[model samples]
Target: MGEVTINNIQKDESGILKENKKINALEDSVENVEVDGEKYDLTIDGYINMQESEEYTLFLRKSTSGDNYVLTNALLSKYPVEEEEQDELFLEDGESLEETEDLKDTYQELYQEVLKE
Candidate 1:
């Protein structure tokens, strides 16, 4: 007589045997976020706290996707830093303003009106 081995498994919708396991939300923690094998840096821009439900949510923004935002759990530690400001450059000494013929005529009329005042 052959011995029988029993496995605590069930077939899924696809007919594949899958082991049953318990999933606990408190034990789950996000270690790192990545897309296409590249790590994505998300910045915490805002937050929402629901005292009634005792839930806290964090809003994050990514520079790669301008103006787009993402929401994640408050426990996430990967936050973005403020970007540095760039200096502005004005016209040089040799640079001059370009005006069209219509603009020149309008400016002359305005100048005459101002002089009369």
Candidate 2:
């Protein structure tokens, strides 16, 4: 294969599609990437375990630098999260009671919208 250009390509189970005029087309393109002089493959499959526990673990795979580390709950609580990235820090799974309550509110709002039909 030739060097993959930074083009807006889409692919599904079939293969890569250069032209996707329709909406909701799959954009799955796995490739090897080099970050901080270390080589790592950007895998689309199983990137995030949706069925797994709510405890998110962010890791830098195959890092040559010593700074590559995993971000656990203990480490997360130690540092004060910046105000700007609040939305990103919010839990998508909502494992705790407080988070669950917020998720419930969002669910109800979405339900109401669906029922309007």
Candidate 3:
């Protein structure tokens, strides 16, 4: 545990700033973790869901926040996704190699589009 900083803050309402009893509290909730004689701050950046399973997921942050490099329980991580895998059409068993290649290309294009956004 670390120290907490309390600062006076003003509230904003409809473009107007008013001084109120609000306090901006900054708490150092981060824990210090040690590995191989070295200590590190275990800060939570964020989390990510498993690509294909809703019950499984991963944290996308640094090597801290408990089990850093492992797939954590979705519920424990507090960032579970309702759906893990994106809906994708499967190629038929008898599909030609060219068709499969075309499908791959299409998937790549859609993935790129999503990344752009």
The CA lDDT of each predicted structure is 0.28, 0.30, 0.32
| TM-score for each candidate, following the candidate numbering | 0.17, 0.20, 0.21
- lDDT tens digits by residue: candidate 3, 1-117: 211121222222333222342222222223346789887644332212222223211222222544223223311322222322323322133434674466545644554554343
On TM-score, the leading prediction is 3
Worst 10 residues of 3 by lDDT: 1-10
Model 2 agreement with the true structure over 30-88: per-residue lDDT tens digits: 34468999866453321212122222112112123342222222112111112223343
Q: For model 2, what is the alpha-carbon lDDT of residue 7?
A: 30
Q: How well does candidate 2 match the true structure in TM-score terms?
A: 0.20
Question: What value of lDDT does candidate 2 attain over all alpha carbons?
Answer: 0.30
lDDT (tens digit, per residue) of candidate 1 on 6-99: 1232223434322443211221122236979986433222211212222222223222444332333332311112221111111122323353
Candidate 2 least-lDDT 10 residues: 73-82
